[model samples]
Target chain A: MIISIVGAGALGKTYGGLLAQQHEVHYLMRSEYAQVKREGGFTLVFPPPQNSMQIEAPLLHQDAKTLPPSDLVIISTKTTANHELGALLGHCIKENTLVLVIQNGIGNEEWISQLVPHNPLICGVSSMKATRLENNTVEIAYIAELRLAPFQAATEKQCEIIEQAFAATSPAIPVKAYQSYKEIRWRKLIWNVPFSALSIIYQQDTQVLATRQPYVSIVRALMNEVADIAKADGVTISQEHMAKMLEATQKSGPYYPSMYFDSIQGKPIEKEYIIDNVLALARQYHIETPMLNLIQTNLN
Target chain B: MIISIVGAGALGKTYGGLLAQQHEVHYLMRSEYAQVKREGGFTLVFPPPQNSMQIEAPLLHQDAKTLPPSDLVIISTKTTANHELGALLGHCIKENTLVLVIQNGIGNEEWISQLVPHNPLICGVSSMKATRLENNTVEIAYIAELRLAPFQAATEKQCEIIEQAFAATSPAIPVKAYQSYKEIRWRKLIWNVPFSALSIIYQQDTQVLATRQPYVSIVRALMNEVADIAKADGVTISQEHMAKMLEATQKSGPYYPSMYFDSIQGKPIEKEYIIDNVLALARQYHIETPMLNLIQTNLN
Candidate 1:
């Protein structure tokens, strides 16, 4: 199966390189395409020492109109860049193309779905952590399950084809399919709302959020608020998941979330989906969210 | 009438100098006793250039076993020092001395009352703003009414003596007596909790709080929470007062509340009284104050 990964960030590079092991995988790069082409490809330091290897994944430029359409095109960009990427996806998509958006926040799938009109939309939330160590290399620091949910009803053969492409990789990243895509996104928000938003506000990393009493209490309140918002949206987020998120943050050590790094680097944040989306939903549900509202106000 | 002003910080110096205009006032100094004595006294720059005057408030050392007794002793110090000051008040209180604590926060009156069990207790909440500048001088930038309320019932003559002492000053700092001392303190907390707590949290001043959107929203939410807590405590903090507080902060310009300055300077904060007292009351009233509670946790 032919696969292409859009938005050449760390997440895109990591997954694309892994899939390139068994089948043809293309990376659509805007800025680094020339450098990667000249160098024949980039390298990926997969998790564990021995798994590291050089990857000669093919690179695709945005200007190439005659490029071959792939069976699957993964949109793995920051949520802030989703609008532009969506427009770009329209130019390359085929009738049966399965477009998967592995991004943070809510309402992203709907936006991408509208941009690419007829293509089947599959949304993904990955726990696998990766970093682009240099201009031509990415390091997969941790590999966890990658969950996928189709926004529209997907036939069994289409689902199997998607799963087979992932399973064929030399060391395939785990994938789990969900029935309700909205529930998956809302559940993901339980962690993202507090960790992403607060990491930026406090200008600290996950370790500090876990260890500090004040931050811990605040993070707890924020998580509970998000859960409340989710429950109002007809998705019941369990207390067990909230506690798991807190514990995971503590165990993750001193890693900065993407939002924190984005803020420190002076990039535009994805507040629209992460914070504003919840606020919009809360307003619709007539629920008061003073805690989330205060945080959102500060982040703004 | 002879009077002594304990805690020789700017707040104490400002009021002590004003009283020294028409009566003898002594200032009890902990660290600057020798310096103040060598300089004869510190100057008081009262509001409006024409009202500014030199003040020769007599200095007293806390170690002096035979300290002068006075008709009234105004305890004006940071709440952080209240514990030690409460112990020290026993050393200087006369049998009939009227003790007026011109301080911030709620529990100082109770603490002092415990130390001097029988003396008439009058609590004064001053809105006059002053700063001790370099070179041993204090500048009274803004003059507002000083509200005085008795903790225990005192004779009319006792109240008159306290009020007259303030009125006799050259450019008298206005003083108003209140019937309910607890109400006055809670009303003051409505302003102090948000400005003081947030100023410390954001590490910014009043101007930032006034101008910034999310911060302004947050400040408003915090103010409302305090008002809610106040209502639970049976003190009706009006919406008018809330608006007035917001307007005051905006008009106050770029001033750092004491708590913010303290946090920046690495000094111990007065969170125990400023934040904890409210939380305790909230707990008692079965009121949830996630906003104030979060700020308090962060400050801790």
Candidate 2:
């Protein structure tokens, strides 16, 4: 099966390179298409001892008039750049093209659903953290399970075809399907809402937040607020989930999150999808989220 | 008249040097006593072309046997060092000593009042911003009016003696006495609570806060919260006073508050007196001070 990844960033390159081991994968990057084609393919370096392999996937440029419709088209870009998605994917998406959006934060799927109204939309929340080492190399920080849920009325066969494309990287890149996209998004928010905002505000990473007393307490309060907002939105988040999120953060060690890295590099932050959405829901539910609002104030 | 200025940091040195122009003044500092005494005298530099003069006030060490009773004893130190005031001032404060505590933040007077119960206690909040240039010298950033109020039952004659001691330097260092110490402290808090907290949080100074929009809005909210807490404590802060405070902040230009500077230099912050007192009063009156509490969380 043919798979096309829209973004060419760390996440896009990591997953695209892994799937390229078995299937025909194509990377869609407008600026770097020529250089990538000239270099033959990019390199994917896993953990030590694992030989770095060349990813020979073909390159797709932005200027192409028409795109070959693939079995699955994965949208893996920063939410800030989502504005260009419609123009980029216009010719690439077919009627039955399984649109799998593996992006961070909330509300991106609803955006795509509006654009490709008839396509079977599969929304996946990935916990697999990755980083681009160079222009032609991508590194995987940790291998965690990816949670996939259908946006609207996606059929089982479409989910199967999407999961099959990732089967080669299974176990290490396992996928778990959920019935409701909203629940999965909220669950992912349990980690994103607190860690992302705090790591930026305090200038500390996951380990610092986990070990420090008041920071740890603040993390609990933010998570609880997110849970309350989610429950008000008809989604119930369990206490066990909260504990698991905190535990995972403690185990991640001292690691600066993507938001912290972006701030240090003076890049545009993805606060709208992460914090703005939670704050909007909080206002709608008449919920008091002082900690979250404080974070929002710092970001603003 | 003799005046012994305790805690010879910036605030201590500035007021001490000014008073030395008229009265026989002495500065009390534990670590810098030998150096200050060896230097013979330190210079006090006012803003611009004003000729900086040498201050020949004697320096007092921590191990000084018995302190010569001063007509006015001005305690100008960070609130954190108030704990050591008992040991330091034991031999210094006389029964009739005018204990004018020109300290920042709250709760210090309460502690000092408990320590030196018999001495007439005067609480003065100085808006004069100054910085220490060397071990003995200090630079007055702005020569503003200093508000002096009796803590308990300090007589008007006592206030007069304190003001008369500062009369020689009155043009550069004006003093205004108030009837209620509580009211003046709360008024000073209208400026301190927000600016100090925000400067530390956003790592920006007063000018940044005044010019910025949302930050300006947050400052108003915090000031309003403080005013509400003050009112609940039986002190009526006028709307005009609030307007004046905001206007003064806007005109003061860019300046880092003591708290921000302290945090940057890795010194102990006076948050307990500034924020904790406000939060305690807020909780006592069943008032909601979410923004202030949010600032408290970050400090913790």
Q: Considering every candidate listed, which one attains the maximal lDDT?
A: 2
Model 2's CAPRI class is: incorrect
Query: Can you tell me the CAPRI class of model 1?
Result: incorrect
TM-score of each: 0.58, 0.57
Off-target runs (Cα >4 Å) in candidate 1 are: A1-123, A126-160, A163-187, A190-300, B153-157
Name the weakest run of 10 consecutive residues (lDDT summed) in model 2 chain A.
A57-66
> Candidate 1 on B152-247: residue-level lDDT in tens?
645556666777877887777677777778888898888888889878777678878866755776687778878888898778988888998788
Residue lDDT tens for model 2, A131-240 = 77656777776667778888865876676666666776622467788888888899888888888888887787888887675578668878888998999988899999
Q: lDDT, candidate 1, residue B102?
A: 79
lDDT (Cα, tens digit) per residue for candidate 1, span A85-124:
7456754578888788898888888788777777888888
